[model samples]
Target: MAVPEDWMGAPPRQPVDLHTDRPHAARVYDVLLGGKTNYPADREAAEQTLAALPNAGAIARQNRAFMQRAARHLVSEAGIRQFLDIGTGIPTSPNLHEIVQATAPQARVVYADNDPIVLAHSRALHTSHPHGRTAYIQADLCRPGEILRNPALREVSDNFEAKGSHVNARSKGEVLRFFHGLDLVDPGLTVVHRWRPDTVEVGAAGWSDADIPLYAGLGRTS
Candidate 1:
């Protein structure tokens, strides 16, 4: 017997409990992103979410766009050359590295995620530029100490660590708390589509907070 072609390159390392019977947030997100890496359960969950929020898919895309815009700004304007992305879900195109490294090929990025499935698909995250580098660590976001201690993340600078989080949603006050010890760049914690909103596209001119309920901000250690 032979496996179907669609089943190729689908298994993760070490055979962790995927729980395909249930919907995983990451996979549901993947589904919303129009990626085929999700299961039936994940699609059903995504549909439910869509039903509740008709623009959920648009919000997802805008959320990713916000990260790209922020990363580009950090690289082109802020002179940031190192990055640490937490909760990096499935391999999405024009990833953080792809965005930053495009402007500064010497930029280094370390993606951290606790999902075993993400670990299995980590290979896609490693296509760093020859001048730069990218690494992935299978770690939980709740354990900041462990991630900070990981050698893969510490190689660039033991004293310097730039963290980026791609979360679903957060209240204005709750989101501000993340930058407690850092000085926020101008126009802090605003709606995602409002941040920059540079790229011209259909309906881009009229995107309101109600259209995309995601927030983005940049902070620097003082």
Candidate 2:
């Protein structure tokens, strides 16, 4: 499963000198996902994390599975047809748009990230279904105005109608706060793997919240 060197894409139009000396969180996550786009620093950081938590890799995969499950539920059950993903990491198989558009072929998705490496691999994010559409923007969450100003994001936003929302929170309190004013889907906020797990993909250990500390929920305005 060796990818060609050119798959990362041609050089950026603007100079995006990477800070390869330091470990970036996204690249470390890429390493955890078994992706080859990370640097030695990222690998070192990932190794350190694994040393402390041996199940980190499994946890990463489970988190990804949770995303796919959530996206599928929104499309198949809630009738949502658009998505705006912020801080999207490296291009992983079965991305949000891929999962959403699979259920609703005409669904549209917009991905925004601050990492220059993600911009280099933006082509993968833009691979839309013939009927659906996808767009990627290099914007930081800290600067909300920049992402809000992008025409593609604006166009997609203008056409959106809220049917439901998916929230990922670091703490149980944060997760509860997000759903405070809304009615949660069956089985409110819970550990990511327990939300709607594919046991074939995640093994017996996935049932334990201790291995994965993230919380996920889907809710709708009542």
Candidate 3:
């Protein structure tokens, strides 16, 4: 199969002015995930946050595990081949792309994040596979429409449909409007952890405003 020539290369890197003096969410996640991309300020902030929620590290790991499981379910059971992942934190190994691509090599993934550090690391670590595709967009969760309309995401979506599979982007309400013509999967527009929880009853009871710092949902284009 001939991959689109225009989509073959990585997106041009936009120069970012890093504010290492203050803490960023992505850097804090990197620190919590035991990555080396974080600064002292970020580490301190992460530690402070962890101090407040003693299970902060565990929660981070659990969140990653949930992402992995969800990607697997989407590829294996749901037959989804394209993904638009917003709030893509640091370039953690076995990321959403890695999990889905492992199950289905033709899976196309577009990761978006507002963090400059995430954008840099995503470009470096989240390149597309030879048989599939991946792209990173420096976009905020508050602008889901922008992400859905991104040139890179549109290209990937086109490729995904050519393979006879579906595409869905995960983000909060800002992007939900972009899926007006699509059908949301069951349990529409809920927290990531709430989707297919290990125990729905326990998960429901545990739900709190703070538990879902970010809203996520899956939808199929109609």
Which candidate leads the pack in lDDT? 1
lDDT of 3 by residue, 113-150 (tens): 87777777777777666899887777876666677667
Model 3 segments beyond 4 Å from truth?
Answer: 1-12, 159-222
What TM-score quantifies how close candidate 3 is to the native fold?
A: 0.68
Best by TM-score: 1
Give lDDT per model, in order.
0.79, 0.76, 0.73
Candidate number with the higher lDDT (2 or 3): 2
Q: Which stretches of candidate 1 lie over 4 Å from their true place?
A: 1-13, 16-22, 156-158, 162-170
Clashing residue pairs in candidate 3 are none
Greater TM-score among 2 and 3 belongs to 2
Decreasing lDDT order of the candidates: 1, 2, 3
Error of 3 at 33 (Å): 2.6
Whole-model alpha-carbon lDDT for candidate 3 = 0.73
TM-score list, all predictions? 0.81, 0.79, 0.68
